[model samples]
Target: MEPKNQTSVSEFLLLGLTDDPAQQPLVFSLFLTMYLVTVLGNLFIVLAVSSDSHLHTPMYFFLCNLSLNDICLSTCTVPKMLVNIQTQDQSITYTGCISQVFSVLVFAYLENYLLAVMGYDRYVAICHPLKYTVIMKPHFCILLALVSLLLSTVVALMHSLMLLRLSFCTHLEIPHFFCELAQVLELACSDTLLDNVLVYVAMFILGGVPLSGIIFSYVHIVFSVLRMTSSKGIYKAFSTCGSHLSVVSLFYGTGMGVYISSAVTDSPRTTAVASVMYSVVPPMLNPFIYSLRNRDMKGAVRRLITAITSFL
Candidate 1:
């Protein structure tokens, strides 16, 4: 085999969501709105948590991080997509594509681990109420956050490095709006057996482990709630969990849909659309789900709005 230079492909053509010129305007408008809303909504969560000292608990700390992750996740993809739509250009530079893949992977995995951490927070609060403060202390919470960020960064770095080793052909076109890891791997000319193996190992360790933690945490929570003698206690416990559970369901459900769609259909477009649900929709809706279902969050947001209004 001839030694191909890494610079063989300087750019990749992104096919985007749809090729219809007529629908371009509508698609652009729709995504622009979603992008703005996602940013603003998650921003509010972060601000509300920061402004309100009453919300300075471990739970809200995690929520703030989750919101930040959502903003980053959306930023990693949407701005580029919006730009492509407006300019009627789908080409992404090789460097830009690599950056996108790295950024998205970091945030995506961070969110995954964060969700599990939040579930653990809930479990400690509900199941071990007396020890909640002791177990989820400020320093401890910070440690958890740091660990999540570090692990995610390491894994994302691994994937990006692996992709860098592979070579691409001249006609480098990606069917998705962004440079999804799977799609990029599929386009590679070099042997992808190692990449596939690494991806599966990552799926099992990174994906399976955190998901198991969330499930275990929730199961303990449910049992604790069921054992409660007081109806009010049960209601309060369930209420606290409702938002997190909803966010969890949305994240994993959409993620599973993307995987299933990709496996079931050979259509990259369909998989791309499904990927939107996990990558785009969940982040956009997380703020709403958390704030609406969480009394402390709503109160904090109201206080935040009132303070801003008074200042203005």
Candidate 2:
């Protein structure tokens, strides 16, 4: 019932992204709007993909998975943060904090792996067109999705279990908007030499590995595109990757930017602002990146828009 090693800190006070009480109202409104956009955007992608038979293919199937993950990831952090802001209650229960940490990691890594998988799907569709339908059958698509979900869930469980074993010291304020791994590790009362190693090692394994997969898939895709006999053919090959390319860039770029910005700025508020690009903006934009840019998705959206308006 109680943590043995440290004084029982019932609720951790999140020293939020800023100590400037003046900015709390502004930040609350901004994040509240972003949260609504993230939810509505990702949810619409799932609904549109599911409702439209024309959109039921390997690409959209993986897309729907990404949209769902984005929604989950955003939900894990943003709403609680907004409530904490408006109520001026920067408190989170021990159980609630841990649950958010675990859920956020699960969906964050899920998006990473899912993006890589979707990249591979595009590789098949564009470079190996003749075999696209056969290779990316309905059962096969479901299997890929299930595997990504499995991996994300498994990793989240492992990391959370490791955290449970560790004890925290008196310092409980997380520097960033959400409980980032590095920030939490800094609060650990017990010897965290192993935990730090594990955390960075995970940063490399989960983050580095999927990132490599995305890069490698694109390399082969580029090579295949170049060998094409005609300009039109090359254009067609590049077009297949347009949506995925944007999503991958948005996710990794903003995430890496957060680290790089923190290295330079050394400011908690700056890091939190950069983190918003990764945690909030990407999810809000992913559906549009896919739907607005991809011709097929554009058509599907048009139909869904028409159908919804018809009922209204």
Candidate 3:
């Protein structure tokens, strides 16, 4: 009596956020609105960055990539959930679930790395303003982005490939809206010691390293700003870092909250709700944080809107 291979399990049922029949339409509408807002908001950020010549700096370069990553990350899970809700069908094929898992990991890690890279960019700007241009050349910025993408892809592929080794049981209902890697792993009938070990290792390398880098960058930035004697210089320094700090706080704060909540609670539904705070809310809020807090970004977005309307 051996467990079935992953291929043999044709599909898994996603229980989504709620099971109440009366709430289906409301759920569908809410997620659809969020998904649309996420896509359009991030898309506008990308377009503004690319269209404005004033935004051709290393910081904007990284911001553009981040906007793209956020769009991909939201697309990875939300659309499938929306489809399931609209169709009243919660089944996701084996291939689709695995693909979702891989895609989610890739974009999530990319976002993490980009945030760290942006932090370093800020540190260099604030700590060594004279060498900012030389330190962050266009080619160097491109290299950092490519390296982040490569590492994110490699790490995600490793996890997804390792998941292929596990054998699953007949009970294939996932209590989450999407095929979260941890939820999927919990359903496996085979011993998941190796899988769990790899997960922990990846968490440390991918998650902890970037977080540490961000903290390190900010430490120097804070010290550099403190050395400035003029009140205007202090205000200018904080203003430059304000949008980035707000975004970083939203991303990591929600993520850490989700992690802690999941660890404390055994309820899958509770965990799923917490996951939305990190996954859905941050992406939706990032564009607003940047555009509203950043004068340059606001001007660029306004110009972009004007150009589009004039052409129409």
Candidate 4:
């Protein structure tokens, strides 16, 4: 049997979280609820930041982008899964799968860069308070966001183009909800040595560098906080960073868990289930983490709600 080029392969079967007929309804309801929460929660964050003049700063600006990215990330995977479950059709067209891979990568990488940028914003505001406005100007903030988006697009394009080169075997069933790049590569019949190498290289450069930046920023922040003589100053510093740190922990912790679980376990299904932690849970929880923990965000949201209600 001749290996077919990716173009010739019309579709791939996605073996979602479970195959149980009885469990489909439960899965559908669970993900539908989660998807709604994730979208609405992130949407509220964006609205709160944009509508409130008080939150028109670097931190909230980065946070607004992060919320948008989270919405995109979840949209890339969950709706398709929901549709698949509801229709009892696991088949995804080749173009659809590739688009999913690219979209997921773009948004996921954007989130990584945005989080690191947010950490740097906090660090500047805390450790170099007088220089915060000068260093993180409005133009610079916009530039940072554009750069993150450009880098994410280029990286995702590279991976997607590489995927286009590979030939796939007949057995094209992916044991996951969405079209994950790694899993798609595994299905390729052609040599994926170069593809695999590129994946790790991109991961290290994209993933490691942002993580390192976040750690470095927070380390400086911690030192600055410790140096504060006033308890009030110390409390203020911690309060400012608490929500971001919690969000970072949730994002990175779940991401690392997915990677570790995938590496340790041989079951693709297990990996799929683990992926929900990073791909679904964090997005749903992030808005709550920020709004509940940060006083400024709470105030902004409250004002936003009041305005909306009064207008209504």
Backbone Cα, N, C clashes tallied per candidate: 0, 0, 0, 0
Per-residue CA lDDT of candidate 4, range 231-272, in tens? Answer: 999989999899999999999999999999998999999999
The digit string of per-residue lDDT tens for model 2 on 65-112 reads 898889989998898888888888888887787777789888998999
For each candidate, the alpha-carbon lDDT, in order, equals 0.93, 0.84, 0.92, 0.94
Runs in model 1 lying further than 4 Å from the true structure: 1-7
- Candidate 2 clash total? 0
Report clash pairs, candidate 4. none
Q: Model 1: per-residue lDDT, tens digit, 1-312?
A: 553445467899999888789988998898899989999999999999998888899999999999999999999999999999899899999999998999999999999999999999999999999999889999999999999999999999999999999998665789898999999998887898988898999989998899999999999999999899999999899889999999999999999989999889999898988899998999999999998999988898899999989999
Between candidates 2 and 4, which one is better according to TM-score?
Answer: 4
Candidate 3 structure quality by residue, lDDT tens digits, 1-312: 655555477888999999998998898899889989989999999999999999989999999999999999999999999889888899999989999999999999999999999999999999999999999999999999999999999999999998888788988999999999999999998888888998999999788999999999999999998899999989888888999999999999998999999999999999998999988989999999999999899999999999999999
Select the stronger candidate by lDDT from 2 and 4: 4
Task: Give the RMSD in angstroms, all C-alphas superposed, for model 3.
Answer: 1.6
TM-score of each: 0.97, 0.94, 0.97, 0.97
Residue 203 Cα positional deviation in candidate 2, in Å, after optimal superposition: 2.0
